[model samples]
Target: QQQVKQSPQSLIVQKGGISIINCAYENTAFDYFPWYQQFPGKGPALLIAIRPDVSEKKEGRFTISFNKSAKQFSLHIMDSQPGDSATYFCAASWNTGNQFYFGTGTSLTVIP
Candidate 1:
């Protein structure tokens, strides 16, 4: 079963706007949460990550909001640009072994 669940499936935003994607997980054992961004023909790469110890994390314009008690998390792209358009995925792992769970993914398009 998919331990992580994502919503909206897709998104469209104007230039300089904000893009948001949400994800939820049912596993309390998941200690690592990471968001990935993938461009066409390329493998997904880590964009941002957080541990349960952190409520939020940010890297440049990308921010990850984590709710430990609620078992949920979200990614927010501020001042989104056309170059920010890509496929985003949320994943959860125990930070050990090879066990990991990924969300369905959300396609983002930033219109010029």
Candidate 2:
């Protein structure tokens, strides 16, 4: 079963604009939420993340807004650039963090 649901299978953003991706999960047991960015042949890399206790987390141009009550979370890319083009995935994990339930994926294209 798909534990995590992600929307907007694809996205296009203008340079300097903001790009957003959303995800939802039903399992309240999940304690960790992480967004990943993947390019062509590379493995997905951790972008930014937020815990259930945190409403939001920001790292440079990347931010993750979490809604624990709604069982939802979103990733926001600020000042999006062409270099940011990649496939983004939202995942949820429990305390162990070994097993992760991932969303389908969202391909983002940042155009100049």
Candidate 3:
């Protein structure tokens, strides 16, 4: 029940376009949801997040839409740029583990 699977393993989009990725989880007990963005040879950093208590959350160019009923969520990158080209990961975890179940990793290329 500790898993979050993401899709499109990789994505190529034009600059100033929208980038979308989806993820789902099996554990209903998970309470905290976070999306991470990582650059080459770097650890993933918290991009944005939402809790089961909310339906969606947004921060600047990044947005996270959560569906509590479906146990699913997605990340949307608005105005994607070449600088945004990197690996993105979707993750889930409870407050207990300090460890998160991560997606296989999505390598995004924003074409200039």
Candidate 4:
């Protein structure tokens, strides 16, 4: 079973709009949270990540909000563009991690 639950199996966002995806994790032992972006026929690439020590993290137009107490995290895409259309996944792992537990991905479509 998956430890993380991701919502909005698919999303459509107007160009320049904000695209948001949410995720919730079950295991408190999961200290490392990472968001990945995958293009078709390619491997998922690390987009952003956060530790329990940090409340939030942002890189460029992407931001991650983590609520450690709530065991939840979310991804926000600002000024979404057509090129940004892709599948997004949320994952969790421990400090001594070997495997990453992935959430059901969200397919995003940025309309031009």
Candidate 5:
């Protein structure tokens, strides 16, 4: 089990509203949970992350809530802004693996 699935394929949120996306994985061996944010023509950058040991992690306006038992996680963007509009991907990797498994991706647009 090495797949991570995310939804909703795309999203449009009003400015200052909250944007939420969900993801789930099939592999229990994955120890590193990372979310990446990518703008057009740019590589994904690590937005925030959490390990299986933690229930939640937050940085700035971004937060990650993880559920180890359900093999699921979610990203929440508080005070959504137009600048925050971009493609987001949920990913997972093991300590020993060189590759990271990514979700199909969610394109988020914040209306100004």
Candidate 6:
């Protein structure tokens, strides 16, 4: 079963703009929410994350907003640039690094 659903299969944003990607999950047991950014020919890297205890978490230009009650979350990329163009995915796990449920993915393109 698809536990997580992502929106905007693809996105195009102007340089220096904000890029937003959203995701929703069905499992209430998921406690860790992490967003991954992947470039062509590269493995997805942890971009940012938030736990159910926090409503939001920010690191550099990447931020994650989480809602426990709604079982939803979103990623916000501020000051988006061409280099930021990549595939973004949202995932949920039990924090054991055993398994994760991922979204389909969102292709983001930032053009100048």
**Tens-place lDDT digits, model 1, residues 26-107:** 9898999999999999999999999999999999999999999899999999999999999999999996775668999999
Clashes of 3: 0
TM-score of 4: 0.97
TM-score per candidate: 0.96, 0.97, 0.94, 0.97, 0.95, 0.97
Q: All models: lDDT?
A: 0.94, 0.95, 0.90, 0.95, 0.95, 0.93
lDDT of 3 by residue, 45-76 (tens): 88898888999899999989999999999999
> What lDDT score goes with residue 33 in model 6?
88
Model 5: residues with Cα > 4 Å off, grouped in runs: none
Model 1 Cα displacement at 28 (Å)?
A: 0.2
Tens-digit lDDT track of model 4 for 28-102: 888899999999999999999998899989999999999988889999999999999999999999977558999
RMSD of each: 0.9, 0.7, 1.4, 0.8, 1.3, 0.8
- Candidate 2's displacement at residue 57, Å, is 0.3
Backbone clashes, each candidate = 0, 0, 0, 0, 0, 0
Give per-residue lDDT, candidate 5, residue 2. Answer: 38
Error of 6 at 44 (Å): 0.8
Cα lDDT of model 4 overall? 0.95
Poorest lDDT segment (10 consecutive residues) of candidate 4: 91-100
Q: How many Å off is the CA of 89 in candidate 2?
A: 0.4
Query: How many Å off is the CA of 82 in candidate 1?
Result: 0.3
**What digit string (tens of lDDT, one per residue) describes model 5 on residues 6-104?**
999999999999999999999899999899999999999999988999999999999999999999999999999999999999999999655899999
Better candidate number, 2 or 6, judged by TM-score: 2
In model 3, the runs with Cα more than 4 Å from the true position are: none
